[model samples]
Target: MLKDEVLKILLSSGSHVSGQDISNKLGVSRTAVWKAVTALKNDGYDIESVNNKGYLLTKNKSILNEAEIETCMHLYDCKVFPKILYFNSIDSTNTYAKKAADLIPSDFLVVADTQTLGRGRLGRSWSSPSSTGIYMSLCIRPNISLEKASMITLITAMAICDAIEELYNISPLIKWPNDIVINSKKICGILTEMSCDMDGIKYIISGVGINVYDTEFPDDIKDTASSLLLETGTKTDRAKIISSAIYHFYEDLDTFMQTEDMSILKSKYESRLANIGREVMILDPKGEYPATALGIDETGALIVNANGKIKRIISGEVSVRGIYGYT
Candidate 1:
């Protein structure tokens, strides 16, 4: 109890504390206190000491290791994705999942504390640092079609956001097609990659990255990035959020499969739309267009109000960046 207080005080302030002060309050000898403080320093805490002064915390970064995340798991079905492959460093969770799914059991979860080659939709680079995020991928192989696989992406996005909403009570808006934004900045990014044969399907791997605790974003994305910590002004438990995300994901995926109708998912999706009814610019290989957002249709297609007529846009080289730029 006293050791924790001594460490907490040293961590909370930049100024040096004294060994005498720690011993006086904790009722422990200076040597016993020194051992405890030294132990915390060895555990990656940047504690500095002077001749008289006790310790001063210079920095504390999240060691986004797997033990902490696994400690956060609350799913009653512990067998479901129980084995998490935690990597200190990895190229990409999705790429690794794709390669590993051939032999690994279904529903195996792979989480990386840091990703060197993280990827986003449209081959964009996903910025993932060790400190403020979760980079996890799950391997799933369902007896579904190559064409109907869009539901997997939609359902997964909804599940992740819904779980966050349930746990943190901070609702994030969906940037239709994929991605979740809070305060007009991206908070979560989803990448769904699958290997399917012409006759049937092989496996589907879904990668999810959520920025939970962050002090800053990359300079290139500073204007367009955010984190749960930045949004709520409080530190969040990463394990709790990740467990909640997976649990909600399983529930929503089951419901989506049972219905076999995207209309049901579409309705629930609209309630969390970030670009609905907003002026937008489309960045596609076909150039660009001016359109008003009409929310997504049942097929997970973006409906655009172009020239007062609704155009149902299916798969194309499309990028919906908001014209008004407000989420």
Candidate 2:
């Protein structure tokens, strides 16, 4: 508790302050200050405890850390609760938040360290490994119409691209409808679900999962799924990555609010879509011929210029695997 209070003070200042100063400010003993620093470090905060000067929070070694996230999000007006409903492991953040959608605030974040049964676009299982990724969901209730609702996924994908490029210096390509691929391997996925009533929309839970720290993936996805640690050969801070996501989430949300049309987020989305302009094949169950990868449409539909005609993909039932990259 003292650590939480101290972290609040330090994070607010955003600069280095002496230990004696922190002790004097908090009205606690110097020994107590030292104790709090150790506790915080044990809790995964990468703090530099100097001999006489003070503690320097080098990094937030995140886990199910709510307070750490709040520190980074001190500038948002949405009043995100970084310290609420955190779990080390759970079934699904989206499923958990959907059950309590009506009860929680609009921007409430439900994050888990690992999800035993995480889900994707369809009923596909989302693999969430422990301490290696960010498995989280946010509940949002927008005033947009149903027709415009389809654009939220595109907006989110663009935001994901921004965060990835900003934080990792990697430009992961966006697979239309919400997938991020790096080196032709999937490093991220977004799962958006909604709950509605006859009156109007209740809320939508946007769940995101990213592979962060594994050098090798499960056998089934060994050739497909990859992580930042695998690609970069270094373990990335999960909290900073989450902060990156939130920071852009706010910016993209602001853009969405201003435009109120998903069209605004399209260009950026297409720029990162690795499938754009590449020769590709679509696995359509209707026994249809394969389509060529043209680009994504405004509504985040995968536009495949097939046989002198253009086909817009709006659903995930059709599989679009790269002919050259993915085997």
Candidate 3:
């Protein structure tokens, strides 16, 4: 806890503060401050210690530790705080979140440095290299019908877009229900699953996987996948991105729950939609069809103009090729 406090102080202060000043402010000893600083340095924080100037956090290439994420949330002044469970390595965050859903808070989160069995939409394998990507799942207990669960995926996609744009200054387009793409390559994927009965909904686990600093992907997905480091040529602050996304997701979810309609968020989502007004090949179990995407409807369904008739596709896989070719 003292290390987290020290990190918060160092991150908030623009200039270096003496050990005595930090100790006096936090009501701790100078020795304790030194210990905290040493721990932080061991956790991959590039802290600069000057003889007369004290300690300064010059760079933060830290992993997705719980304390670091809480510090970022404190910096942003997030109102809705969630209980975070962090793991250096895990089988799957979603699996753990689901197993602990009954014991943890409704706004609980499970974050892992790597997932040995990470999954994507439709049970596909998601490459989650250790300490190179973000693998997190938020367990939410919403007071809504089961049919409205799909909208939460769209909400998360928009929240991720907001966070990425805030950090990188680059806008990523959303590919239908749960994929975020940059330069026609997949950078993030979201999978939302729920448990419910006939009465209403119980809990929803929205898992998000982001390739933050991965330079090399698996051979199967090398051409289709990308990372923030590969796309922007910069190492991203994973803690800050996570905090920003959770903050924005809470704000957007509040708005969505109030209206129970995607119309309030439709324009913003459509503006970043990759397939809007573009030719797409729809893959459905019934049949495959070629159509031009119009936009999303109020309920978050894909509205496309198939041939001369209009079609509202509830669920399917779509392929689109632009200047970057098919993905």
Find the candidate with the highest lDDT and give its number. 3
lDDT of 2 at 174: 78
Model 3: per-residue Cα lDDT over 216-310, one tens digit each: 98999898889988999977779888999999898888889878879789998899898888887777656677888899998989888889789
List lDDT for all candidates, in order.
0.76, 0.74, 0.86
Those runs of model 2 whose alpha carbons end farther than 4 Å from true positions after fitting are 10-20, 23-35, 44-52, 58-64, 75-84, 198-200
Structural similarity to truth (TM-score) of each candidate: 0.77, 0.86, 0.91
The true-versus-predicted C-alpha distance at residue 316 of model 2, in Å, is 4.5
Clashing pairs in 1: 17-54
Best by TM-score: 3
Number of backbone collisions per candidate: 1, 2, 0
Say which prediction, candidate 1 or candidate 3, comes out ahead on lDDT.
3
Over 1-327, each residue of candidate 2 has an lDDT whose tens digit, in order, gives 688777766666655667888899999987888888788878777777666656788765545466666665564443233334678888899899888787765467787888999888768888888877888887778776655566777777776778778778878787766788888888888988887766645777778888888776778888888887787676656766777777777677777767776567667776787877777677788855667777766666788988888888765558776776643
lDDT of 1 by residue, 217-246 (tens): 889878888888889887766666777777
Candidate 2 vs. true structure, TM-score: 0.86
The segments of candidate 1 whose C-alpha lies over 4 angstroms from its true place after superposition are 1-68, 76-82
Poorest 10 consecutive residues by lDDT, candidate 3: 317-326
Q: Give the per-residue Cα lDDT of candidate 3 at 195.
A: 88
